[model samples]
Target: MAGYKFFMFDPDNGFETYKTAEEAKAAADEAIDYYRGDAGDGWPDEVAQVCWGEIKQETQQVGLRPRDEEDKSSCEMICDYQLTDI
Candidate 1:
């Protein structure tokens, strides 16, 4: 089935597809939280904080498009998680 795709601006990341927009948004929110120091350990040191700070900036900026839509900056692929896999 076709999916909804969202572009995550993290340099190491790319377009990700989900079965629904809610799922995509939830995933993005989780990543945003992690980047904001929601990780259990938080930022360990200044260098680590500084490095991930850049990612935190970009992670807040996201773009969404339908699966069939064309986006020159990224490509899409489904990454759905199955219930059984949970």
Candidate 2:
């Protein structure tokens, strides 16, 4: 697990990838805040927190797509990035 891994997150499109888990994690925290209906600079609301809770039950991987996106290309892309090791 110490070797580099690839992750995709959005604040931008196209090249939205992370080289480290910590980077992906920051994006996940931001996503939780966004879902929590925070101004993203303010406290989280109950509904948003509940949304976070639900997604948490789904997966711990920060920048991964939803569980339903099981396309082979998506899996390939993650692997492709890992292989590239940029």
Candidate 3:
């Protein structure tokens, strides 16, 4: 079976794998909600926007990225999360 990954901070919890797309989407929504909540005040609006874009892109065309194409950005200042296979 294929797996879905919800992007997160790298070097530690880079991303989370889900057995289904719905699960992955829920994870993505939870992350986005956190970023859009009070805790997000420390971050720029772009961060949330970037995260939303990542989720949107994944929903539009679900797929995993090649390991070589993975972007390991800190995802602090910008959205650099990439959905990948588990």
List model 3 lDDT by residue over 26-51, tens digit each: 66667666556656358545444423
Which digits, one per residue and each the tens of the lDDT, describe model 2 over residues 1-86?
22335443434222234556576666566665555565566654432322111111111333444334555464433421122222
lDDT of each: 0.41, 0.41, 0.45
Q: What is the lDDT of candidate 3?
A: 0.45
On TM-score, the candidate that comes out on top is 3
Query: 1 or 3: which has the higher TM-score?
Result: 3
Number of the candidate with higher TM-score, 2 or 3: 3
Error of 1 at 45 (Å): 17
RMSD of each: 15.0, 13.0, 13.2
Highest-lDDT candidate: 3
Which stretch of 10 consecutive residues in model 3 shows the poorest summed lDDT? 50-59
TM-score, cand. 2 vs. native:
0.31
In model 3, what lDDT does residue 8 have?
35
TM-score ranking, high to low: 3, 1, 2
Model 1 clash tally?
A: 0
Clashes of each: 0, 1, 0
Candidate 3: Cα lDDT at 5: 38
